[model samples]
Target: MREMNYFIVGDVHGCYYTLKKLLQNWDSDRQKLIFVGDYINKGKHSRKVVELVRELQYRYPGTVCIKGNHEYEMVRYIEDGTKNSDIKENFRNTLMDYDLRNKYRDDVKWMKRLPLYYDDGDIYVTHAGVNWLGLRKFKENSSWCVLRYRGRLKRMSRLQVFGHTPTESKRPEFNKKSNAINIDSGAGNFDNMSAVLIDDAGKIRKIYTEQIRKEDYH
Candidate 1:
């Protein structure tokens, strides 16, 4: 069995350029890249975003991926909603093309089928944080995701890495738990963007693209 040296990335949010830039900076032909999801939304190139992810996943077999809230919501809007979602401007603006919009719906349904977590015998990876309120009742296919997802997986014996709640605030007012780490860094907030890699020991290694592009967000 191979000891996992995973390189986990935060929410890409259609920042394909930045994501490509970050991957280049990482400069590793060896390390496995694990993505925590929210690969679309809040930025341009959502259609391009999923394609890249799929390409990489194909290139690297067994690369772990979990679906995020944005992905979950988009699928809901497509499969169950009576009309198009009227939430906000975010990344969907860039997906106005008919083909890309249809692609997003297909991608979302695909994302819905993804596993909620990945455990390589050392680190556990998830999209949103595990649920805390009803941890006992939580499962990978749980219907409620945004609110109580993290608390759901708190019982995992190993370190859990997740992205959803942005870690943009430097004050550290967010989760201080040693077991779970958040790396979203507001990339999908249409604000500051960041992603980090965690070692097998659950230590944070590097954070890329600390500064958000003014044009990408607003």
Candidate 2:
């Protein structure tokens, strides 16, 4: 059997066209697609972005979509009916998109079930990198670490790839000492969406990006 490569995507906050262009680099037959999440909000096409991601997941059996902090906030808002201003503000765009499209219940249910991380032995993918305490402690009590962790991460046995805090350089940042990478290029904000290709051994092979299209973000 041939070794499967992985295309780990960064935070995609409703940059539908940008993500579409980025996936042009993906080889579905040889590469597993993994999205770090935040598929909605902060952009104009949240509905289209979620629909496209859902379609991709259905078409690709190897696709993995991890939960993100934005997803957590939206889920909490929907389920708990929170009056928290921050959550409301963060979720407003997504809510408006869903309302306009008349699709929310099913997608919210799907988001509610999203996993916090993906660990395939050699590579670990999550929305956010773990803290200095390491993955074991994170797995034991992962209230917010998996989806919201920031700053320096703990060195781990396997390479950890995550996307949550957008890199200041507008590019993916790799930390050799910790064996980790941050791929968030602020697709929902000022930068482009980015993804990294890695071999079965967890070696980064390439970086792919798509500049945010005005139609998708504006």
Candidate 3:
């Protein structure tokens, strides 16, 4: 049982360079990279981001890549071409970015199996915040909960961290009232990319993409 630090990153919507910058100092051997989903769509290098995540997961054990709504739509579009309209319009760009528009079956298959959330007693990580009804209701809602629920959530026994709703603020959104942290400050919503480091006891140390690209720091 190797000791590992938990690092959660929210929504990497095709910002390949930004994601690269964020991981430049990451210690994969000792830190677990938990992505809170929405890894694709809205960015130019969606393929590269996916590839990088796969590569990192291969190099590091305990790395968790939970699925986002975009992934769910991508899987649907891949499985049934006429399934989703929004994704269908942007599907070519997404596939072409990786050198394929109607293929990459393996990647699609990989995305399909991504879990919706992860919990480890003290912290809860999901693509979106759990609704006010609580965890049991969240489980019952499943994809709806992970993909659509919004606003401040009710406080739970553990800290809840999520990233589906993008915030205009440059920093990750933290709600003291609900004990929820939103890390989706990335270019997915045309803002800076943010990543948070959580210690074994659930303390947060946040870093934004501009830390390395200081010229863009605002």
Candidate 4:
């Protein structure tokens, strides 16, 4: 079997232009693109970002899109129509984006089916890093631990890559203690989106970033 390199993307959070620009570095012929979710909300182009992600999946058969906390919250909002003001506030931009495009129902369905994580033996990609004892629990319950956990991660057998809590430096952060990486550059909330290239051996080769364009978030 051919060993495929991975381009693990961070939390997109609806920065379509930023994602579009960063993806320019992806080499589809040799690299499998993996998105660590949070594709919508917080920014202005949630609809466009989702559409682009779908298009990439359609065109690239091996693309992996893992579910993030934002996606989980979105599903809950659609299903419960909860009166929680915080949830409503968090989803305001995304809801408006999909409402204008009339794609909320369909998009929610797609988001619901997304897997919580992606593991390729050599590397494990998820929205949040699970603790040493939490992996099995995360699988059994699909709980918030996998989607929202922000504590220090335990070192795993394989390299762990995740994005949820944005890096304070607005760049990918590597933790030698846990052998993990956090690639969320806070695209929707900050100025840039980030991605990391990992080789077949699970070693991060490089980091890529794209500045969020005003048109993408305004």
Winning candidate number (lDDT): 4
For each candidate, give its TM-score against the true structure: 0.78, 0.91, 0.85, 0.91
What value of lDDT does candidate 3 attain over all alpha carbons? 0.74
Model 4 earns a TM-score of: 0.91
**Model 4 weakest 10-residue run by lDDT:** 135-144
lDDT (tens digit, per residue) of candidate 4 on 1-218? 87789999999988888888899999998899999989988888888888899899999979999988888788877777665465568586567547622445788888889987788699999888776666553652355467877787878888999988888898999998899999998786857899999999999999998888887755
Q: Every model's Cα RMSD, please?
A: 3.6, 2.5, 3.7, 2.4
List candidate 1 segments past 4 Å from native.
1-4, 85-95, 98-106, 133-156, 168-176
lDDT per residue for candidate 3 within 1-218, as digits (tens), equals 77667778878777777888877657777677899988777777778788889988887757999888888777766677653344555565676555433556778888888887899986899888787766453452354476657765868777788987777676787788888888887556557777887777777765555422332222
Q: Give me the displacement of residue 67 in model 2, in angstroms.
A: 0.3
| Residue 97 of model 4, lDDT score | 44
Backbone clashes (count) for model 3: 0
Tell me the number of clashing residue pairs for each predicted model: 12, 0, 0, 0
Candidates ranked, most accurate by TM-score first: 2, 4, 3, 1
- TM-score of candidate 3 against the unseen true structure: 0.85
Q: Rate the local accuracy (lDDT) of all candidates.
A: 0.63, 0.82, 0.74, 0.83
